[model samples]
Target: MSLPAPLDQIAVRRAVEAALAEDLGRAGDITSAATIPGSAAARVVIAARQPGRLAGLQLAAAAFQALDPAISFEPEVEDGARLGPGDVIARIVGPARAVLSAERTALNFLGHLSGVATETARYADLIAHTRARICCTRKTTPGLRIFEKYAVRCGGGSNHRFGLDDAILIKDNHIAVAGGIEAALRGAKASAGHLVKIEIEVDTLDQLDRVIREGADVVLLDNMPPPILREAVMRIGGRMLAEASGNVSLDTVAAIAETGVDLISVGRITHSAATLDLGLDIALG
Candidate 1:
């Protein structure tokens, strides 16, 4: 039940507030308002309906707190905790209206982030014995990249660059536009700050040779099979960080890892992970 470092409270607060706004638009929980008395209170337990790695607890708590400052959200598990079926994630007690109003928003955060974490864990665990690490790419859900990346870490996976601004990854298009790999490398090197590393993607070992000569911090071996990947790693010989991208899946990740590349970047972990099923049930006091 290890916990990752706490998410930025400011970020969590802003995201939760915005989500709550979207859900409680205009009239603001009219269903709850119409049915529940002003003084009515209720207790509930949010439980996992399937196995997963937990994440986004802070956002879940913030969702309820935004509506009712006095709401009690006693968490039974922390982010990064591996959950089992029927496990109670948290206990909530508050104004019945606030509880009902915040339920969907809270579970939305929990389920989505937990799903990302759970999927990442599946890949990470498979390649645990190998030197390679599982990494999530920029193909993340819009407006939810930070949360999803954090969830990846909670699942024992590493993160790729957070965005285009964080690092320079010269893709095939960039090379084509810049005239060639050498030209792209020259341009990126000239423009980059001292702290920034330049990474260039290459499809074939010929391009990799040019990159090795041109010099870069990391080389992305795009879509190469395990045999080619192993050869590329040998060619690089620890000169630049070796990363494999494209066509990576649970079935083939182990083979990719055994090739000795430093990172295996998978986009599906964030873009296509299924929502972990979770539900809030009103508790009888």
Candidate 2:
């Protein structure tokens, strides 16, 4: 599937470059030196060791290509496809030393990201009956936010702000520092350009009421109980979008979605997702 137009492909490529740099450092893979010769050629299959969703194929290919320009990647399965154990997701032919060098880094990107997508897809499936949609938050790996959020989309979850510049989010800190919710709301609204919509995070119904009175475009109902979230949704009454966030786990997402909120932002999707099981098996021609 094509990535969203709003996504900057250059930025994504740069991120992959940065990651490759971190792994390669000044000298390229030193470990591959003692084992594999420079002119060696090999064919490898990236296989899924367990059944789950797949994502980040192109990014992984980019990582390998960065290591060896001669590397060729043939994706047998597309991103966002559900796979079973023993499935060959990709076939790669390249310099043996370069393939060995890029193996772990490439698998690291795909495994962790595809794991997030798989986990998010499970939550999305749980809330499929509800009007609420699963969304991801800014709580991502420091530099890997784009990749993580992209994986979220692959899993059927929507993305929140990619960064602070793209949207105005007045959280509790902003309210405390700005004096009050109304003050923060007014300040954000006044300073924001016509295109910027402000979303304020509120922990209580009382705070929610105040923001509603001040006119917020979106309210992130943080850590609210199911009853309170439902009440907040009714209070807002379609005037603004109600977003349920905090403590959102697979077990609780369905209940949160049942509260009639427009969105559910889960942080754990990217922050703590386990890497999916995958491996690259070299084949002899």
Candidate 3:
């Protein structure tokens, strides 16, 4: 698959700058300033502790550059690449104190985003043979939704609507407040622009039938079992995109995919993924 575009350079710079400021504090890296000579130079390598996919090399590079504009960060492999234990992701050469000061912030972005990518890849790989594609939900870290979603793409997964503004998603609550699916769909369709697609969540075959009859752009099959999902897809019959979600895990994902839904949306790929273990160690010549 073609790689997703790299993050906007301005966004990268701003995030790392904020992180470096927060980490530096008023006193700065006092220990490094005191112990490491200003003239001292060091080389470091970021190595993986376990096997997984890579993401956020750009942010890591930005972190170092934020501290020292002259820092040289050479990425050995791009984001979305697979990693093995002891795999050297990138090499950094710069003043010793600046390198030490930026290490944690750089690793923080790298590890969290890599975790998101790796977890997504695990789900994507399982459903690769099926017609369904893995996708991530808005259940992402508050300010890091874009980054996490980008990481999902890095793992060979697809992206859902980026925000409430991206499309009209009439959920269970919307239906309840709007009185019924038909009313909700009617209101959404009336308000939506020519380009906006409307998706609605349904939990039962009856609701799916109503949504299909009423006409929607996509149907979210919320928490339905494999059999129910299969029936829902059959009911859809190519009229609307069918998406399944709720409490999905590795053991059950393959089965869910076999049900032939168009997409499987998982929230944990961002909110609950374990951070991939990566470390910046001094490179010895």
Instruction: Give the TM-score ranking, best first.
Output: 3, 1, 2
2 against 3, candidate with superior lDDT: 3
Q: Judged by TM-score, which candidate is best? A: 3
Residue pairs whose backbone atoms clash in candidate 2: none
Relative to the unseen true structure, what is the C-alpha lDDT of residue 164 in candidate 3, on a scale of 0 to 100? 91
How does model 2 score by TM-score?
Answer: 0.93
Q: Tens-digit lDDT track for model 3 on 15-52?
A: 88888999999999999999999999999999999999
How does candidate 3 score on lDDT?
Answer: 0.94
Give the per-residue lDDT of model 1 (tens digit) for 15-133: 99999999989989999899999999999999999999998999999999999998999999888989999999999999999999999999999999999999999999999899998
Error of 2 at 57 (Å): 1.3
Q: After superposing candidate 1, which stretches have Cα over 4 Å from the reference?
A: none
Candidate 3 error regions (>4 Å): none
Worst 10 residues of 2 by lDDT: 1-10
